[model samples]
Target: MNRNDTPNGSPAAPQASFSLRQLSDADWARFGAGEIAYLRPVTVNGVHAIAIHGADGAPIGAAPNAELAVAAILQHEMAPVLLH
Candidate 1:
């Protein structure tokens, strides 16, 4: 699931700051970093937890559950995607 440029998982075209076809290195590195977040189940120190990842496929934070994770993502104005 991707939000593309929108922060709510919407496919609606964004007001492009730059061309999508020829993304530069810096833009590619920050791909989706601001618009989307995702959740992955993980165990931290033997305790089950949900890991939050940015659109760039990097870990940003963690939450104990999906509900709180979603809330946190929303609070930060980023769309959340749940990974199975």
Candidate 2:
């Protein structure tokens, strides 16, 4: 089963994507700005690395491996997603 699946093979309920309590257009634009981050594979100075960026495409950090990349993202309370 996938991450959104239940033991019985049913899909789980969807989680909230953004807050309804947002106060303005700016708030909507930054709905997941800090909560979700993307992991992109990159070559830094001829070395393989993972670059982490916020949902808005701003750089946050990087790591030599995916494990460390994920750990760093989680430590910052953000969800990590792999980019294709």
Q: Pick the candidate with the highest lDDT.
A: 2
Query: What lDDT would candidate 1 get against the real structure?
Result: 0.88
TM-scores for candidates 1 onward, in order:
0.62, 0.64
For candidate 1, write residues 1-84 as lDDT tens digits: 565645766687657785687988777878777999989999888999999999888889999988999999999999999877
lDDT of each: 0.88, 0.90
Which parts of model 1 are misplaced by more than 4 Å? 1-29
Q: How many steric clashes between backbone atoms does each model show?
A: 0, 0
Report how far off residue 27 is in candidate 2 (Å). Answer: 8.0
Question: Over the stretch 1-84, how does candidate 2's per-residue lDDT look in tens digits?
Answer: 999999998999999886787568676558689899899999988999999988878798999999999999999999999996
Q: Candidate 2 vs. truth: CA RMSD?
A: 8.2
Best by TM-score: 2
Question: What's the TM for model 1?
Answer: 0.62
Worst 10 residues of 1 by lDDT: 1-10
